[model samples]
Target: MTGDLILYTNPMSRGRIVRWMLEEAGASYETRVLDYGTTMKAPDYLKINPMGKVPAIVHKGVVVTETAAICAYLADVYAEAGLAPAIGDPLRGAYFRWLFYAAGPYEASFGDRAMGIEVPADKRAMVGYGCFADVMNTVEAAVSQGPYILGETFSAADVYLGSQIGFGLQFGMTEARPAFTAYWQRLAARPAYVRATALDDALMPKTA
Candidate 1:
């Protein structure tokens, strides 16, 4: 808990997701706000992550990249934060499922839709997301059974999925299906989420 935590990020990017995770973990961290243009392509930051992406972390001398990986790592490292299910717990499997699903299918499908890329139904198996409709339907079914992803208890999976749903609704990229609407409400009620979002809001410009 006494080690240095340097989070390289831009306030408006996916880095915000890791910010929520940091708040949920109750960990002390420093933000090195990297702007999207030349700053991200600079040599020093590129060494940390070849992709030149934000949401990368340097904790206790180890560097972690990728938003979902960072979130999962923080939850496991700060076990007392109770952001993850216990190792042998049955819920652990489901926790991993949603986390990976959000990073994989959900993100892939969102990009495909936004870019207007169409995958033929016969070749859908070659695409990671398969189909946009399938991805949406699966997520809707999962959240509909919830107060949380694993039922009853909140976990890091909720942070990842909840953020996706929040973004989806904000951009109208995905429908406000009843289950997603309910899940979004549940996640918005979290004190940590409120605090993190307020902090992010303060750091960035307000949009109408």
Candidate 2:
């Protein structure tokens, strides 16, 4: 494993998710902490992510942004970590299914809700998630059969989607349904999760 992996992130942001992923992959990486408005939007960082976002990774001269994409990319690059199903594995389909589901519908639906924006019932067809309730119900079903998303196997899909589930429950964006709480409990207990979270927590700006 080369030490060429660089993670550009802010402690209080979605970067924590990638931190967890890197820890899970047992990757050797350097963290470059960027403040939200200043360093994050500066030209040097903008070259890394034009949108000026947190949680971007540069590995061996290649840049990857977007939380889900970063997790997926790292999983493939570090195959020995076994964070992904093999390409021809039957479970591969379901892996991509729930991974993108969390990135898309699950995130979109909850983002809209957090901002107090509600799609009209008549316009539900135009909205990808249909409704917040539908998204929540579908997510509940996905995790209900778990010890992990792929039954007994844990993968990058769990790390990415599981982080979203964790954020939702933490911030009151998701209800404390029995299934959601239990699933997060299982994921949170991971040593990787604990290590990643402790690292970021220590970097968080201290309050006066």
- Top-lDDT candidate index: 2
Model 1, span 1-208: residue lDDT tens: 5449988887789888888899999999988888887889899999999998787999988999988899899999889999999999998999999999999989999988999998899999999889999999999889978699889989889999899999999889989888888899989889889988888888896679
Clashes of 2: 0
The TM-score of predicted model 1 comes to 0.95
Clashes of each: 0, 0
TM of each candidate vs. truth: 0.95, 0.98
Candidate 2: regions farther than 4 A off: 1-3
- Candidate 2 has an lDDT of 0.94
Tens-digit lDDT string for candidate 2 (1-208): 4459999998899999999999999999999999988999999999999999899999999999999999999999999999999999999999999999999998999889989999999999999999999998998998988699989999999999999989989988889999999999999999999999999999988999
Local lDDT at 2 for model 1: 42
